[model samples]
Target: MAFINGPVPEALDREVAATPAEFERDLRKAWPQGVRSDASLSLELNDGALRLTILLEPLEPRRIGLLTLPRLCARYRFEGGDERARTALLTRLDRAMQRGGG
Candidate 1:
């Protein structure tokens, strides 16, 4: 690349750095009521990837064989291979949240 502009600005870098924690906090606040009190929501950043984990508890009890599980969990990993990949992943997460995923 030639000389046009440098890397991401320091202020933008700080905002980006703070995004994950803010996002996690917002998710926790908006979590579904059906989720258990001990359920956890976390985010992990790796290179160009973002990993979100949602641990949920069923609204009602479930019995499988003779064992009973307290909650169910899912991990969604978004790796930005292209410009639109990140947008798509975010849209997917938004839809899931609107649908009350728990």
Candidate 2:
């Protein structure tokens, strides 16, 4: 896949179960210098050699009986990396963020 403003951007969007602060903290473990806006984040890898822009959209909390779960739509945009590198980056991130699943 072509990165660095070639063709189209490689993006992924997933609904996550956490607050922005929680998600950002986990992200910072990998991307320490990620920039945060009102509801978004811009991350980098390889000392800025590659970029990942994250846009967070808050969604209505899902209520389960007496309990509730936070929800957000996280959009990731990849730039300036090959498919292998990008896939590896995303895989690492996913592994880091996933928790408490059967």
Candidate 3:
């Protein structure tokens, strides 16, 4: 896992559970087109840091009549640092989620 040295905003921690759609939307935006698959998002908080992971599993071209397991496509970690830095990082993360990180 990679560590980003910065402060994690309290608001983000609160939103983690309150706004799950935000995370799902971001994952869908990051998902590749023309790929028949399903995705899952995982969030973890530890020691004032947040980790977001996107896992994708193909749905088509089934083998042995079983869907393939999801694979990690993206993993992001935000750490808590100074208030100013934390705010900046949180803003970036919010925008990235809205824009699908493209």
Which model scores highest in lDDT?
2
RMSD of each predicted structure: 16.5, 5.9, 13.1
After TM-score superposition, the amount by which residue 55's alpha carbon in candidate 2 deviates from its true location, in angstroms, is 0.7
Between candidates 1 and 3, the one scoring higher on TM-score is 3
Please give the lDDT score for candidate 2. 0.67
| Weakest 10 consecutive residues of candidate 1 by summed lDDT | 9-18
Error of 2 at 76 (Å): 0.4
Q: What is the descending TM-score order?
A: 2, 3, 1
lDDT of every predicted structure (CA atoms): 0.35, 0.67, 0.39
For model 1, how does the per-residue alpha-carbon lDDT over 5-73 read when each residue is reduced to its tens digit? 333211111111112334455454454422222324434333244333333222233459997533323
Clashing pairs in 1: none
TM-score: which is higher, 2 or 3?
2
Indicate whether candidate 1 or candidate 2 has the larger TM-score: 2
Best by TM-score: 2
Mind giving the per-residue lDDT tens digits that candidate 2 earns over 20-102?
Answer: 78777777775555545453344344524567777777799999999999998888788787776676667667666667665
Candidate 3 lDDT over residue span 14-92, tens digit each: 2132133444555345432211223354543232343333332222332355644222324344455556655554455
